[model samples]
Target: MTLLPDPIISTWLFSSVVFGPWSNHVTGWWEKKQTHSKLLYLFYEDMVEVNQITTSCAIKMLLELEYSIQVRGRVQFENMKKNSFVNYFTSLAMDFKISPFMRKGKVGDWKNHFTVAQSEQFDEDYKKKMKNITVQFHTVV
Candidate 1:
């Protein structure tokens, strides 16, 4: 069985925590749709899409934008793509029988799991909840 038995519940909770008010406050930019000099909003999909060959360049640019610091060398970037960090973390999670931090790591994986009715319900609920929110997600479904 998948670690996340209920994708809806898990997705809701993850979204609520990651994109919720708390995260916005921490970043100090989400509430205000306009870009802040001090805050750099970096979406994982955006970064990956910007350069599919290597996310290092995108990540470096984001860091520079956020901290105004120069990130030197390709070593760190190569390491980031190696999956060593993810493997280590996932191994720990496995030892504890906890949900894996990294699942399929593929975009639009929900299409494989969510039923038609469930997808419709989620979409309706999402639209209603996000109607007043400025942040938008580029979802596949």
Candidate 2:
């Protein structure tokens, strides 16, 4: 599950891809229903981090949960470690100019996009909506 960015930067993309079809309400409901074991939530910033370790861990969990595959010692595991699919897919996305998907894939990019008022409003709304949700996001990229 992809996480929404902090309200500061999220306002710019809130109505776009960031929260395009899903909201915290929907995600919270799903998280409650599935519980942590069945549902793995991943943050985009973490996934695109400098080392990509978080992304690798998410991929490993997906393989284990969805396919019931033990990632260690598997061909799929080795390929993922080498980021074969991720590299290829990123290249394709770059070729297509999918800016939202590829642009400045980093943490704290919201600092570059959001105004103070917008950020405060988003924070208020986020706190109200996500108050009961137990899942927390990583603040660092």
The number of the candidate with the highest lDDT is 2
User: Candidate 1: where is the Cα deviation over 4 Å?
Assistant: 1-29, 32-36, 52-97
After best superposition, candidate 2 residue 102: deviation in angstroms? 2.8
All candidates: TM-score: 0.49, 0.49
Q: Each candidate: what lDDT?
A: 0.49, 0.52
Query: Candidate 2 residues 15-118, lDDT tens each?
Result: 54433423554566557756557465655555445334654565566665444343432323334445534434443424533343334444776656656666
| 55-81 per-residue lDDT for model 1 (tens digits) | 444545456544322333322334444
Candidate 2 residues lying further than 4 Å off, grouped into runs, are 1-38, 48-56, 64-99
The superposed Cα distance between candidate 2 and the true structure at residue 127, in angstroms, equals: 0.6
